[model samples]
Target chain A: MPRTVILGVIGSDAHVVGITILEQALEAAGFDVVNLGVQTSQPEFVAGAQDHGADAVLVSSLYGHAEQDTRGFHHRLTQAGLGDVTTYIGGNLAVGQDDFAETRETFREMGFDRVFDAETEPEEAIAALQQDLEIPLTETDAEEPARATL
Target chain B: MTRDKRLPESELQRIASDLRDDWPTAEAVEFTEAVEYHGTLPAEKRFAEVLETADRPLLQPRAGVPRLRDQIELLEGLRTEGGADLLPTTIDSYTRDNEYAKAQEGLEEARETGEDTLNGFPAVNHGVDGCRELIESVGAPVEVRHGTPDARLLAMITFAGGFQSFEGGPISYNIPYTKRRDLAQTIEQWQFVDRLAGLYTEFGVTINREPFGPLTGTLVPPCIAIAVMVVEGLLSATQGVKSLTLGYGQVGTLVQDVAALRALQSLGDEYLPDDVTVTTVFHEWMGGFPPDEARANGVIGLGGATAAIAKPDKVITKSPQEFRGVPTMEANAAGLRTTRQLIDMLLEQDVQIDGIDAEQEFIERSTRALLDTILERGEGDVARGTIRAFETGEFDVPFAPSESAAGQVLPARDDDGRVRILEFGDLALPDEIREIHRTKLDTRAETEGREPSFKMVADDVDAISEGRLIGRPDGSNPAPSGGDD
Candidate 1:
C-alpha cells in the first residue's frame, strides 16, 4: 500500500503555490496524498491525519510566522494519538534571513523529523520521505532519476 | 446563491453599523462627517486624480508598519527618496483575516516593544483618528492594500479616515489570499464597501476602486486575470463606483505582459458602465524574486520597461528585498526609484514590438470567451455567474488557495516564454483557444525533447527565481540578465 501523507499550509498564511506544487510532486512520486490546502490549523492537521490514516504530515508556511503558528503542534499531535506519524515542515519558516541551521534546529527540537528551507525542491522532500518511510526503490523511481537539482 | 445586485440603502446602513462594532474604533466612523473630511483633502492627495492627471505612468510602492508614526515615516521616505507618485498601506494578515483583537494585540506589542510585530499597518486597530493622522502626514495619496475576504470594517474606517483609493476584489483577494472564505459572502460584503465608495462619490468625493489584479501571483494566464478584473469592475460599477482601476501583474514575458495590460484596459472599458472611468495598474513581477538583490533589480527593470511600453496608468513597484517577507522602508523606496529610473528613461522612446496587436487580440478573444461563459452562467448577472462558474469549475485560478476555485488550471511558459495553459481543468475556454495553448506547449515540448507534463509546470514556477524565464531540462539557457532579452 502507498504511504498516506497529510500536507497543508499552517496558520493564517495563505501561500498555496508551494504546497500545490509539492502535492503534485508527492503524488507523482507514488504517495497517497491528502492535501489540506491553506489556512489549516493544528487540529485540522491532526484530524486529517487520523481520518486518512496518514503515515506522514507535511506542514508548510511561507508567511514567516511558522514558529508562532506551530507552537504546541506536537503536543496536539500526541494528544490525538498521532505522535508516531512522521512529520516534516518547510518553506520560509521565519521572518528574516536568520540562520537556517538554527531554524532547522528549532523545529527539530519541536519534534519535526526534518526541516526544509523555502528553496528546498520537492524532490528533496520526496527522497527524504522514501528514506524515512523505508519505501524501497521501485521501477518507476529508478527509470525516472530524481531531478531534484534542476 | 447570492445574486449580483446593489445593496439597498437601509441594508448598507445596518451592515455598516454592525461592522463598526467589530472594534472600538468603529464608533468614530460617521458617514457625513467622513464625507466632509474627504472634501477637505487637497487634489493631489486624491488617488484617482493623481493617477489620471499624471503625464507619465505613476510609481507606487507597497509599504506598511504596525505603528502609525512608522508608517508615516515610511511613506514620507518613499515619497521623498523614492519619488513615489502613490503610496499603499498594506494591512497585516490579522487585519486581513478580520482578527481585529489580534491585530490590536500586535499593535499594542509594537508600541510597547518599539518593534514591528505585525507585517503591515493594522488600520482597524489604529482607528479613524490614527488613519487620519497617517493620511495627513503623508504627502502622496494612500490606498489600503490588503488580502481581506471581508473588507467591510477596513473600508468603513479607511474611507471615513480619508483614504480615497482601495485595492482588492471578491475573487482576486479570496482565491489568492485565503483558503475557505465564501465567495458569495465576500461579494456581498464588497458591495457594501463599493456602495460606500459610490456614496462618497455622490457627495462630490470620487473614490477610486481597484480590483487586485494579480490572482494567485503565479504564472496566471492573462485571460484569467483580465476576466476577474472585468467582473470585479462590473460588480463595483453596479454599486456606483465611478472610478475604477483594473490591475495586471507582470508575467515576466515582455510582449505577453504588455499585451495583457492592453487587454485589461480595453476590456474593462468595453464591459464596465459608461460612467465609470477605467484605468490600468501594472504590478512589477509578483512571483518569486531572485534572492540576489542585483538580479532582483533586473526583474524590476523589465517590469518598468513593460510598463513604459504598455503605458499603464499606475505601476506598483516591488522592492529588491522581496525574497524576505517584508522589506525595510529604505529598500522599498529604492525599488520605487529603480522602477522610476527605468520608466523615465524609456517613457519617451517610441519602442514598439511586433506581434503586440496580435497577442492582445488573442488575449481579448480568450477573455471574451471566459466573460461570455460567466455571463451565461450568471444568467446575465455577473455575481451569480461568477459564483456558479467557480462552483462548477467553469472558472478557475491556477494554484489558488480558495476552495471556491477549481485550482486545476496549470500554466507553463511556451517556447517564446508566453504563459500557456498546460492543464485546463473545466475552464470555459473555447476548443480553439485550448488548441492554441496546447499547440504552444507542444512546440515547447518539442524544443525540450520532453512531453509537456507537471514537471514543466514545476520548473516554470521556479524559473524566474532561478534566473531564467523558461525552465529547460538541461538548464543550459541562463538569461544574460534577469532572464529577459
Candidate 2:
C-alpha cells in the first residue's frame, strides 16, 4: 500500500490557502493526503495519522509562532505511540531574524524528520520523502485513494 | 458596567508609574531627548494634524530596523528620498508577540551586524528614550504601527518617547493578529492603552489612535471593515481621544473603495462624540502581491489612483517586496514615492461626486445596522457590546483564526472585483442590501457558468496577481484546486 500523510496548519493559524496549495501538490505527486485543515490540534494530527496508518505528519505555521506552537508537537506524536511516523514542520517558523540553522536545529531536536519552508518547493518535499521512506517514485498506486475527513 | 469613561487620574498615574518601574526609566528619559525631531516643531506636531491639513492624500510607508540608529537613517531616507508625509516605526515580530527577551537579543545582534536581524523596531527594548530618538529623527509626525494584542508596554514607551499616533484596537488587533488569545483579556489590556492616550489628551497632547481596518486583509466586505472601525472609534472616544483616524483597506474596486471611505468618515462623525475629530485613512492592497515587481507596481499604482479619486486624508503604501519578505528601505521608499507622485497628479483631475450610489448606501446601511445591533447586544456599552457581538457572530471577520469569531462569513469578489459577502453569518444587514450582494455575485457566477462555491473564493484569493479582479472560472485552474485541505 502507498503511504498516507496527515497535514494541517497548527493552532490559531487561519492561513488555509497555503495548506490547500501544499495538499494539491502532494496529491498530484501520488501521496494519499489526509488534510485536517486550519487550527488543527496536535492530538488531531496524531489521530488522523493513526486512523489512516499515515507515514508522516506535516505541521504548517505562517504566523511566526511555529516555535511555540510546535514545541510539543513531536512529543505528542510519540506520546500517542506514533513515534515512527516521519514528521515535517514548515513555513515562517520563527518571529524574528533568528538564523535558519538554529530554527532547523530546534525542530530537529523536537523530532521532526524534515522541515519545509514556504520557499521549499513541494517537489523537494515529495522527493525527500520518497528517498527517506524508500517509496516508489512512479504513480503505481490506484488513482482513487480514500480521503479521510476530519 | 458603563460603556466608556476616561481612566481616573490616580489610576492613570499608578499605571504609568508601574509601567515605568518595569523598565529602566532613567535610561528611557535619555532616549527621548536624543530624538532630534522631538519637539522640533514650534507647536507639538501630531499625526492627526497631517491628515487634517493635507489637501491631497498624504503617503506613509512601513519602515523599521532592529537598531534605533538604523531605523532613524531609514526614516530619513524615506522622507528625503521617498517624500513621506508621515513616518512609521513598525515594531518587530518579537515585540509584537511580547517576546521582549528575544527582541533584546535581536537588538544586540543588529548592533553587531549593522544589519537589522529583526523585522521591526524593538520599542520596548529601546525604552522611552530610544523610541523618542526615532520619533525626533523623522521630520514628520510619527506613529507606532504594530500588530500587537497587548501593546500596553510598547504604547507607554513610544507615547512618552514623543510618538503622537498609535494604531490597533482591542477587537481589530486581537481577532486578526492572534489565535487562541482570550477576546476579553486583550480588550481589557487595550482599554489601558486607550486610557493612556486619554491621559495625553488631558495633558493637551492631541494623540490619534487608529483601529486596524483590514482585519485579516482577505476579501473582507466593506461593511465588516467599517463596522469594526466605528466601534473601535467609539471605544477610544469614550476614553477621551480627541482626535481619531478611522482606517479602511482598499478592496480593489473604485466606487466601492470611495464609498467605504466616505462611509467610514461619516459614520465616525456620527457615532463618536461631537467633540472628537475624525479623519479617514485608506490602505493600499494588504493581501498577496504579484511575484513580478513590475506587476506589483501596477497594483500599487491602482491603489494610489483609488486613494486620490476617493479623497482619503492619507494612504498607506505597500512595497513591491510584499510577496518576498520584509521590504528593504529602498523598496519602502519607492512605494511612498510612487504613491505621492500619483496622488499629487490625481489631485488635479476632477472626479466629481454626484448623489449617493447604491454601493455607498449599501455600505452605509449595512454598517449602521451592524453598529445598532452591537449597541443593542451590549446594552449600551461598546466594550461589552463588542464582546457579546463577537461571541454571537453579530461581528465576525473573514479568515480570522480567533475561536471567538464565527468564521461563517465568507467573502467573494463580485464581477467588478469589489468584495461581496457570500455569507453574512449572523450579521444584521437589511434584506435589500443582502439582495444587492446576492444579485451582483449571482450575475458574475452566471457569466462564468459555474456554481458559486469555494473554488471561486479560492480563485479570487489569487485574482489580483493574475491580472484579473473577479476569479472567473475560465478553464485555467488557479494552481489546480482540491487537495481537499
Q: Highest DockQ: which candidate?
A: 1
Going through the candidates in order, what is the number of backbone clashes in each? 1, 4
- Per-residue lDDT for A1-150 in model 1, tens only? 789999999997778888888887787787888999999999999999999999999999988999999999999999999889999999989886699999999999999999999889889999999999999878125544232211
- Return the lDDT, model 2, position B396: 86
True contacts kept of each: 0.48, 0.03
- Clash list (residue pairs), candidate 1: B378-B385
Candidate 2: regions farther than 4 A off: A1-7, A11-58, A62-75, A81-150, B1-3, B25-41, B353-356, B475-485
Off by over 4 Å in 1: A64-85, A93-114, A132-150, B477-485
Q: What tens-digit string does per-residue lDDT give for candidate 1 at B1-485?
A: 67778889999989988886689999998989998998899988998898888889999999888999889998999999989999999999899889999999999999999988899999988889999999999999999999888999999999989999999999998888777889999899899999999999988889999999888889999999999999999999999999999999999898999999999999988998888999999999999888778888889989989988999999999988897648887888889888888888999999989999999999999999999999999899999999999998889999998999988888999999999998888999999999999999999988998778778888998899878889888889665553221
All candidates: DockQ: 0.38, 0.11
Docking class of 2: incorrect
